[model samples]
Structure formats: C-alpha cells, structure tokens
Target: MADLRVELCGVSLKNPVIPASGTFGFGREYNEIYDIARLGAVATKGLTLLPRPGNPVPRIAESRGVILNAVGLQNPGVESFIKNDLEWLRSKTKVIANVAGSTIAEYGEICARLDGLVDFIELNISCPNVKCGGMAFGVRPESIREVTAEAKKNCPHTPLIVKLSPNAESIPLNARAAEEGGADCLSLVNTFTGLAIDIERRRPILANNTGGVSGAGIKPIAVRMVYEAARAVKIPVVGMGGIACAEDAVEFLTAGAAAVQVGTANFGDTRACLKIIEGLNEWCDRHGVSKVSDLTGTLVPNA
Candidate 1:
C-alpha cells in the first residue's frame, strides 16, 4: 500500500483529493451517493454575508469539453451555514468553508463568523462586488492582498487558504500577494472567464453573458498556472481546473501542487473523487512510489 496522506497548513488530510467550492455544494446531496468521509475535504459552496439568488436562467452552459457557469456565487448565507450545516459537515469529514464577500469588512465578518468552527477558511475573491460596479476583487493583486489580510485577521484560529482567479494578469504575482497578506496556503486556477454564444438567437448562452469555465479542456492551462504559482509562493498550492482522473491529478502534483481539487468531474460522476483516490494509489504502487507527496514537483524536463 502507498501513503496517500497530505498535510497543508498543519491540517492533515487522508489524501489530497478535495472537492472544489461551488461544485460540491454542502455535501449532503453527494453523501447520498457515496460516503462523504471518503474525501480529503469538502470546500463548500461559496458563501457570503448574505444569501444570493444568483444570476438569471441559463447560468450554466456546456462547451465542447468544458462548462461555463455564472452562478454568481449563489449560496446560503454564512450564518445559515453555521446554524444548520457546519456541525453535520464537520462530523463527516474535514470542512473548508469557501467564503466570498463584496467588501473587506464583509470578508472579515464572514471569516470571523466561521473562525474556530471549521477545519479551514478558503477566501474567495472572485465574486463580483455590486458596490464596486461588478468588479471582482480577485482580478487585482492589490485587492487580493487586502482581502486576504482582512480575512486572516478575523479568522485567526483557522488556517486561511486563498483561492486565486486565473483571470488575473499574473497568477504568480497574485499568489505572492496572498502570501504577503498572510495566506497560510493557496489554491489556484479558479474557473477561467469565458462565454458561449447562441448562434440562432445571436446572443450569449449564459444570461450573465460571461461565465467561469471549468472541466477537462482546462487541464493543461491549469497545470501551467499551478506550476507558476507554486514556484512563486512559499505556501502550499492546491491545484484544480480540469482533473477528471487519477493521471490528471498526478499532473497537478508534478506541477508543484500540494494537493488537487476535483471539480466539474463530480457533476458527471458522483463518485469521481473516490475513483481518483483509488487511481492515485494504483499509480503510486505501479511506479514504486511509497508516498504520494513524493510526486509533488517531480516532473522532469525533456532532455
């Protein structure tokens, strides 16, 4: 048997196969399909200070090998999650509360609300700030630092994992900004900004016009960004983009990710994470690798 455990920011996971935020929901629905305990951790849907109804109809549309979603961070508010879902989720497996907010105060307050309650607090700066005229806090490195710092200040007891947006001008720069702002760990390659048009209607498929893209089509680009951010930051990097199988997860590990998050694949196969875990073990055994962590950043350049 191979060792599959991974430790990030002092939290030890049974394995490195976490489910990305917004994709896994609160875990109750998926738990009906498979044991939620089987996962390393579950990054819950992006939560805010207040609940959001999300965008209009047609928020999700499928591309050739990818998916575009402008769910608009729709989720139950932070207080509701604490009052209803927090304890049950913690009892099942590790919890990474994925948080989103419009202002620095909102971020701090939500983090404070979740502080000392969950296993980790994942700061999500990707959602648009209505007050800022629809600008996402994540697109700018400066805002990334500011938001990370504020959230860190409030969530002093829990480790902070800042999720970076791929839409940024420089991923590594934003990663460094997070570290500078006191991020204990970082997760990257959040869905890319994309859109699809309906030829017949001659309009955007998504009601919001633009949406975040994810799935197998994004694997290579995500791997590249993971490599860049990993090299630039001292903190651990949790990579996720288009990982659908064990080999795909290994690619991110080799690209310098401390762990990998399984996203859109879960939509297709409810048991995707479990299968990927099995695949990781099989691959490790076949390659004579004793520990999965040994594969991190093990990629060799072509001679």
Candidate 2:
C-alpha cells in the first residue's frame, strides 16, 4: 500500500484532496452520500459576519464545459455555523472555515471567533472590500497583504490559508503578498470573472450580470496560475478549479500544488471526492510510488 499522508502548515491530512469552499457547503448534504472523513479536509462555504441571501434568481448557469455562479458569498453568519455545524463537522474530518468579509475589521473579528475552534481559517478576500473603496482585497498585492495580516493577527492558534483570486493582474505577486502577510499556506485560482448572456432576452443570465466561472473549461488556465503561484511562494499551495478526476488532480500536483481541491465536479457526482481519492491510491500503487506527496512539483520540462 502507498502512503498518502501530507502535512501542510503543521496540519497532517490523510491525503491531499480537499473540497473547495462554496462548493462543499459545510459537508452536510454530501455526508449523506458518503463518508466525507475519507478525504483530506473540507473547506466550508464562505461565511461572513452576517447572513447574506445571495444574488437574485439564475445565480448559476452552465456553459459549454464550465459553470458561472454569482452566489455572492451567501452563507449563514459565523456565529450560527459554530452554534450548529462546527462540532459535528469537526468530529467528521479536518475543518477549514472559509471566511469572507466586507471590511478588514470584519475579517479580523470572524477569524478571532473561529481561531481556536477550527483546524484552519481560510481567508476569502476575493469579495469587494467596502472599506477600501470597493476594490477586491484579493486583486491587489497591497490589499492582499494588509487583509491577510489583519486576519492573521486574530487567528493566532489557527493556521491561516489565503485563498487567491485568478482575476488579479499578477498571481505570483499576490501570492507573495499573502505569504509576507503571515499566511501559513495558500489556496489558488479562485473562480475567474466571466459572463453568460441569454441571446433571446439579449441580457445576462445572472442578475448580477457577471459571475465567477468554474468547471472543466477552466482546468488549463487554473493549472497555469497554480504553477506560477507555487513558483513564487515558499508556502504550500492548495490548487483548485476544474479537477474532476485523479488525472486532473495529478496535473495540479505536478504543476506545483501541495494539494488539490474539487469544486464543480462534486455537483455532478456526490461521491466525486471519494472516487478521486480511490483513483489516486490506485494510480500511486500502479506507478510504484510509496507516497503521493512525493509527486508535488515533480514536473520536468520538455527537453
């Protein structure tokens, strides 16, 4: 049998197959389909200081090989998650509380609340920073550093993982900003900014007009960005975007990701993560590999 264990920022995961935030939804509904604990970790839905109803109707639309979503960080408040789902989720597997905020102070407050409780706190600074003149904190290197530093200050007991947005001008620069700001690890290639129009209506399908694009179509771009970010930062990188099978996960690992996360794939198959985990194990054994972690950043340039 091959060893699949991987340690990132002092946290040991049984493997390196985490479910991305906004896709996993706290692992409750999926838990009914299979034992989620079999995976490495679960990054819960993006939570905020207050509850958000999310965008209007048609928040999700399917394109050729990808999906567009304007969910708008809709999630129950932080306090509610702790009061209801925290203990149960913690009992199942490692918990990475994906947090979002409208302001830097809100990020700090939420991080402080979940600091000692969850296994890790992942900062989702991709949303608009109301305090910073409506700019996304994750878009600019400066805001990424500032927001990460503020959040890190509140989560002393918990490791901080900064989730990066691909819409940035420079992924590596933004990644370095997070690392310098005290992030223990980083998750990259958040949904790409995209749009889908209804030809008949001659309007956008989503009320928000634009949404985050994710799915199989994004694999190539996501892989490229992950490679760039991994090369720029010493901290471990958790790569996501269009990982539907073991091969896709392997691609991300070789490209320089410490681990890979499955997002839209779960929507298609409730047991997607489990299947990928099993596939990874079988592939490792067939390849005569002792541990899967050895594959991280193992890509060789073409001669």
Candidate 3:
C-alpha cells in the first residue's frame, strides 16, 4: 500500500481529496450515505454573517457534460452553522469553512467569527463587493489582494486559503496577487461565467441570466489553468474545476496541485470523493510510488 496522506498549510490530511464548497453542503446530508471522514477535508457551503434565500427558481440547469448554476451563495448563516452543524462536522474530519460576503468588512467580520473555530478558512472571493457597484472581488488582481489582505488581518489564528475565481483577466497574476496579500494557501478555478439559452422561448435558462459553468467538459481547460496558477505561485494550490475520477485528479497533481477538490461529481454520486480516494491509493501502488505527495508536479512535457 502507498501513503496517501498530504499536508495543506501545516494541516495533515489523510489524502488530497476535499469536497469543494457549494456541492458538499457542510457534509451532513452525505454523512448519512457514507463515512465522509474518509475525505481529507470537507469544505462547507459558502457561509455569510446572515442567511441568504439565494436566487429564484431555475437556479440549476443541466446540459451535455456540464451544468450551470447561479445559486447565489444560499446558506443557513454562520451562527446557524456553529450552533447546529459545526460539532458534528468536526467529529468526522477536518473542517474547511468557506466564507463569502458583500464587502471587505463583511469578509473580515466573518473571518473573525470563524477564527480558531475551524481548521482552515477559505475565502470565497466570487461574491460581489456591493460598495464597488456590485463588481465581484475576484475578477482582478487588485481586488483579490485587497479582499485577501482584509480577511487575513481578521483571521490571525486559522490559515487563510483564498479561493480564486476562474473568470479573472490573468489566473497566474491573480494567484501571485493572492500570495502577495498573505494568503497561506490558494484554491481555484472557481466556476467560469457561462450562459445557457432556452432556444424555443428565446430566453435565458437560469433566472440569474448567466451562471457558473462546471463539470467534466471544463476539466481540460481547468487542468491547464491549474498548471498556470500552480507554476506561478510558491503557495500550495488546491486545484478544483471538473474533477470526476481519480485519473482526472492525477492530471491536476501532475500539473502541480498540492491538493484537489471534488465538486460536481458529488451531485451525481454520493460517494464520489471516497471512490476517488480509493482510486488514488490504487494508482499510487501501481506507479510504485511511496507517498501521493510525490506526484505533485510530476508531469513530463515534450519539448
């Protein structure tokens, strides 16, 4: 057997498989189906200081190999999570609290509240900074640095993982920006901005008009972007976009992801993360590798 354990920002994970935020939902519902403790970590749904009802119906739409979503960061709020789900989730595995907000102060406030409470705090930079005319904080390198710095100042205890948006002008530049802002770690390629249309009705499919695109179809592009981001930064990168199987994850590892998060796969299979974990063990054994960490940045490119 091979050693599957890996470390992220000084924290030990049994493996490199963490379920991405938005898809896992705090790991409660899935815990009923499988032992979610098998995962390296569970990134909770995007949390805010207050609960959000989310976008209107038609929030989720399906297509070929990808899906579009504009769920609007719906959640039960930070206080509700601490009071109800925190303990139970902590009992299972390491917790990665994913947080979002409408302003830098809101991000700082929420980070302060979660400090020392979870193993890691992942700043979701996708949310719009309302004060900036509703422009998302993750679109440019400047905003990424600003929001990450603000959040890190408030989270003196827990390590801050800035989750980068894929819709940026330059991913590597943004990755470097997050690093310069004092981010302990980084996770990316958050869903890409995409549009799906109802041809017959001549209307947008999702109520929000446009949605974040994710799934197997985006894996190739995601892999390339992950490679770009990982190569440009000294900080560890948690690559996530359209991973569905172990092989897909191995590609990310080869491209230089220290860890990988499984997202859309969970919506289809309850035990997708576990299955990928098992597959990682087998692949490592077959490759005569000792530790899975050895596979990071192992890809050999042709001249």
Candidate 4:
C-alpha cells in the first residue's frame, strides 16, 4: 500500500484529503457517518469574535455543477466554539480553526485566543459570503500582507494558513504577499464571485446580491491558480476549489499543493473525503508511488 501521510507547514496529516471549512462544521455531523479521525483534518466553520446571524435568506442557490452561497459567516462565537466544540473535535482528528473577522484588530484578537489551542488557524480572509472584512482584505496584495502579518503576530504558536481569494487581481501575488507577511501556509482559491438571477422575478437569487460560486465547475481555474501560487511561493500551499474524487486531488497534488481540501462535494456526498482518500491510496499503489507526498510538484511542465 502507498503511504498517504503528508506534511504541511511542519504538521503531519495522516492523509492529504481534508474536508474544507464551512462545509465540515465541527465534524460532529459527519462523525456519525464515518470516524472523523479518518480525515487528515477538520476545518471548522468560519468563526467570528462574536456570534453572527449571517446574511439574509435565500443564501444558497443551485446551478449546473455549482452552488452559490452568501451564508455570511454565521456561527457560534469563537469563545463558544472553544467552550463547546474544541476538545471533542480534537479527539477526532486535527483541527484547523477557520476564523473570520470584520477588521484587522478582530482578526488579531481571535487568532490570539486560538493561538495554542488548535492544530492550525486558517484565516478566512477570502470568504465572499460576508460583506465586510472577508474578501475586502483578500482583494489586494497589501491588505493580504498586512492582515496576515497581524494574524501571525497574534498566532505565534499555532500554524497560520491564509486562505486566498480567487477574485484577487493576481492569485500568485496575493499568495506571495501572504507568505511574505508570515503565513506558514496558503490555501486557495476561495469561491469565485458570481451572480445568479431569476428571469421571471428579474432579481438576484441570493439576498447578498453576489455570492461565492463553488463546485466541480471551478476545478480547472482552481488548479491553475494553485499551480501558479505554488510555483511563486516557497511556503506550503493547500489547494482546493472543486475536488470530489481521487483523480481531482491528484491533479492538485501534482500542481504543487502540499494537501487538498474537499468542499462543495461534501454537500452531495457525506463520504466524499473518505472516498477520495481511499481512491488516492489505490491510485498511488497502481502507479507504483510509494508515498503520496511524492506526487507534489511532479507535473511535466512542457507536457
């Protein structure tokens, strides 16, 4: 059998397949279906310094091969998360606490609180669902650097993973900016800004007007961005967009991602991450690959 263990920013993952944030929640719901510990790590839902009710109704809309959401960052506050879910979740698998904030100060405050608690603190600077502070800090390289630096300053102990926005002017530049600002790892591309309209109603489907589009449809764009960012930065990159299968994950690994996060697909299949993990093991074995980490950056450039 092939070794699926992988190292990201010095932390070891039993496998490279992680259930992306927002989608995985606290891993409690999915734990009933399968042992959540089987996962490389569980990224919690986007948490704020205070609890949020999120955006208005009609937050999720379905289209072909994709879904658009503006669910805001609705969640039980950071303190609540720590008091309620932290320890139980840690017993299952690694925890990547996905956190969001409306300002740099807020980002720092939350990071400071989670400093030595979680295995990793994933900065949700690219969430398009929230109107404030989410994608705002992720649009420009300067903000990306500044916010990341602030978050890193507060989170000196825990590994910080800055989630980059796909809507940025240059994904590579933003990624490099995060690295320069002290991000231990980078993850992209967060959902693309998209609009879905109702013809008869002549109005936007989502209450937030625009939402983040994610699903199988965004894989190619995500892969290209991941490759570009990976090549540009020396830090580990966690690639994700539309990964529902083993072959999909293989593409991201070959593109130079230290690991891949499985999002949207989880809504359609509860065992998506497990299936992909099994598939990766089988695929690697058939290809004579001894370890899955060997798959990273193995793409043929000229081909």
Candidate 5:
C-alpha cells in the first residue's frame, strides 16, 4: 500500500484529505456513518468570539454544478465549542479550529482562547457572504497581513492557517501577505462571491442577495489560484473549492497544495471524504506511486 501520510507545519496527517470547515461541522454527525479518526483532520465550523445566529433564511441556494451560501458565520461561540466539541473531536483525529471575527481584536481573542487547544487555528478572513469583517479583511493584501499577524500572535502554541479569499485582487499577493504576517500555513479559494436569481420571483435566491459560491464548478479556478499562491509562498498551502473525488484531490496536489479540503461535496454524499481517501489509495496503487506526497508540485508546465 502507498504511504498517504502528509505534514502541514510540522503536524502529521494520516492522509491529505481534510473535511473543510463549515462542511464537516465538528465531525459528530459524520461519526455516525464512519470513524472520524480514519481521516487526516477535521476542520470545525467557523467559530466566533460570541455565538452567532447567522443570516436570514434561504441561506443556501443550489444551481447547476454549484451552490451559493450566505449562511454567515453562524456558529456556537468559542467557549461553547471548547466545552462541547473540542476534546471529543481531538480524540478522534487532528482538529483544525476554523475561526472568524467581526473585528481584528476579536480575531486575536478567539485565537488566544483556542491556542494549544486545537492542532491548527484556521483564520477565516475570506467569507464573501458575511456583512461584517470576514471578506473585508481578506480583500486587500494589507489587511490580510495585519489580521493574520494579530491571530498568529495570539496563538503561538498552535499552527495558524490563514484562509485566503477568492474574491481578492490577487491570490498570490494575498498569499504572500499572510506568509509575511507569520501564517504557518495557507488555505485558499474560499468561495467566490456569486448571486443566484429566482426567475419567477425576480429576486435573489439567498436572503443575503449574494453568497459565497462553491462546489464542482469552482475546481478549475481553484486549482489555478492554488498553483499561483503555492508558487508565491514558501509555506504549505491547503487547496479547496470544488473538490469532490480522488482525481480532484490529486489535481490540487499537482497544483502545489500540501493537502486538499472537501467542502460542498459532503452535502451531496456523506461518504465523500472517505470515498476520496479510498480512491486515493487505489489510484496510487494502480499508478505505482509509493507515496502520495510525491505527487505534490509535480506539475510540469507546458513549454
């Protein structure tokens, strides 16, 4: 069997497949289907300093090959998560705490609170559908640097990962900024800002009017952006967007991602992550690849 183990910022993962934040939701629900410990890591839903009720109704809208979400950052406060979900999840597998805030100070507060409690603290700076500080800090390279630095300072014991937004001016620039600001790792292409309209109603499907777009439709663009950002930064990059299967996961690896995150696919199939993991093993065995990590950054540019 091929070796599927990979490391991110010195933390070793059993494999490179992680359930993206917001999609896996602390792994309790999924645990009913399979052992959560079988996967590489579980990224918790976006956590805030205080509990958030999120946005209004019709938060999720489906379209051809993709989905739009304005779910906001609806999550139990960090305190509740620490008390409720933290240890249970940690015992299952590696825990990556996905956190968000409405202010730069709040980012530090949450990071500090979760410091040493989770394996990784993923800073959610690129949520497009939110009305507050999410996308605001992610759009510019300057703020990406500033907010990342603040979060990193607060969480010295845990690895800090800055999740970059696809709605930014330049993926490479924002990636470099996070690297400069002390991000131990980077994850990208967090949903593109998109709008879906109801033809008969002549109104946007989501109550927020606009939402972050994700799913299979964003794969190509996500792969390209991942390639660009990976080339720009020295730190490890975790690629995500529209990944659905093992082949999709391999594409991100070839594009320079140390690992990949599965998001919307989980909505359609509960076993998507596990299937991808099994598929990866099969694919590697068939291709004669001894270690899956060898596939990273193996893309050869067209001459």
Candidate 6:
C-alpha cells in the first residue's frame, strides 16, 4: 500500500481529498452516509459576518455534464458556525472555514473571530464588494491581494488560504498576488460564470439569470488553470473544479496541486470523496508510487 498522506501549508492531511465548500455543507448530512473522518478535511460553506438568505429560488440548474448555481453564499453566519458546527466538525477531521465578505473590513473581522478556532481559514473572495460598486474582490489581482492581506492579518494563528476565482482576468497574476499578500495556501478555480436558458419560457433557468458552472465538464480547463497557478506561486495550491473520480484527483496532484477538493461530484454520489480516496490508494500501489505526496508536480509536459 502507498502512503496517502500529504501536507498543505504545514497542516497534515491523511489524504489530499477535501470536500469543497458549498457542495459539502459542513459534512453533517454526508457523515450520515460514511465516516467523514476517513477523508482529508471538510471546508465549510461560505460564512459571512452575518447570516444571508442567499439568492432567490431556482438557484440550481442542470445541464448535460455540469450544474449551475447562484446560491449566493447562504449560511447561518460565522458565529452560528462557531457556536454550533465548528467543534463537532473539528472532532471528526480538520476543519477549513470558508469565509466571504462584502467589504475588506468584514473579511478581517470574520477572520479575527475564527482565528485559532479552525485549522485553516479559506477566503472566498469571489463575493461582491458592496462598497466597491459590487465588484467581486477576486476579480482583480489588487483586490485579491488586499482582501487576502486583511484576512491574513486577522487570522495570525491559523493558516490563510486564498481561494482563487476562475473568472478573473489573469489567474497566474492573481495567484502571485495572493502569495504576496501572505496567503499560506491557495485553492482554485471557484466556478466559471455561465448561463442556462429555459427555452420553454425563453428565459433563464436560474432565478439569478446566470450562475457559477461546475461539474465534470470543467476538469480540463481547471487542470490547465491549476497548472498555471501552481507554477506561478511558491505557496501550496489546493486544486478543485470538476473532480468526480480518483483519476481526476490524480490529474490535479500531478498538475501541481498539493491537495484536491471534491465539489459537484459530492452531489452525484455522496461517497465520491471516499471512493476517490480508495481509488488513489489502488492507483498509487499499481503505479509503484510510494507516497502520494510524490505525485505533486509530476506531470511531464509535451515539448
């Protein structure tokens, strides 16, 4: 058997498979299906300083190979998470608190509150900056840096991970910017902006009109972007996009992700992360790889 352990930003993960935020929903429902402790870590849904009702209904839509969502970061707020879910989740496995904010100050405040309470603070900078005319903080490298810095400053005791937005103008530049802002780790690519039309009504399928696209259809593009971001940064990168199986996880690791997060795959099969973990063990042994950590950046490019 091969060793599946891998370290992300000095934090040890038994494996490199974490359930992505939003998709896993604090791992409570999934825990009823399987032992979530068997996995690497669980990233909580995007938490804000206060609770949000999220976007209107019909926020989720389905296409052939992917799904679209404009859920709008609905959550019970950071205090609620800390008071209710935090301790229980930490008892099972590493807890990565995914946080978002409407302003840079709010990011700092939330991070300060969650400082040493969680193993890591994953910043979801994709939220619109209400103070800045509703521009997403992750859209620009400058804002990515600013928000990352603010969050990092407040969470000095915990590792700060800047989750990159795929919809940004320059992923590599943004990755570097996050690094420059003192991000201990990084995760990407959040979701690609896409629209689904309901031809029957000649209108949009999702009530939000457009939604973030995710699923198996995004693996190739995500892999390429992960490779680019990883190559451009010294900090560890957590790759996620449309990973559904173990092979998909391996592709991200080899492409330069120190860890991989399973997202939409969780919706298809509740045990997707576990199955991927099992598949990885079998794959490593079959390939004669001793440690899974050795798989990072192992991709051989065609010259």
Q: Per-prediction TM-score, please?
A: 0.97, 0.97, 0.97, 0.99, 0.99, 0.97
Per residue, candidate 5 scores C-alpha lDDT tens digits across 68-95 of: 9999988989999999999899999999
Q: Which stretches of candidate 4 lie over 4 Å from their true place?
A: none
lDDT of 5: 0.94
Candidate 6 C-alpha lDDT tens digits along 1-303:
999999887889999999999999988999999999998999999998899888888989999999998888889999999999999999999999999887899989999999999999999886431223123788888888888898898999999999988888888999999999999999998888899999999999988888889999999999999999999999999999999999999999999999999999999999999999999999999999999999999999999
Query: In order, how many clashes per candidate?
Result: 0, 0, 0, 0, 0, 0
lDDT of 1 by residue, 71-130 (tens): 887887988999999999999889999988777898899999989999999988764323
Give the better candidate number (2 or 5) by lDDT. Answer: 5
lDDT, candidate 3, 134-207, per-residue tens: 23888889988898899999999999999888777888999999999999999887888888999999999998
Give a tens-digit lDDT track for model 2, residues 217-298: 9999999999999999999999999999999999999999988999999999888899899999999999998999999999
Estimate the TM-score for candidate 3: 0.97
Q: Flag the better candidate by lDDT, 3 or 6.
A: 6
Candidate that beats the other on TM-score, 1 or 4, i.e. the better one:
4
**What local distance difference test score does each model get?**
0.89, 0.89, 0.89, 0.94, 0.94, 0.91
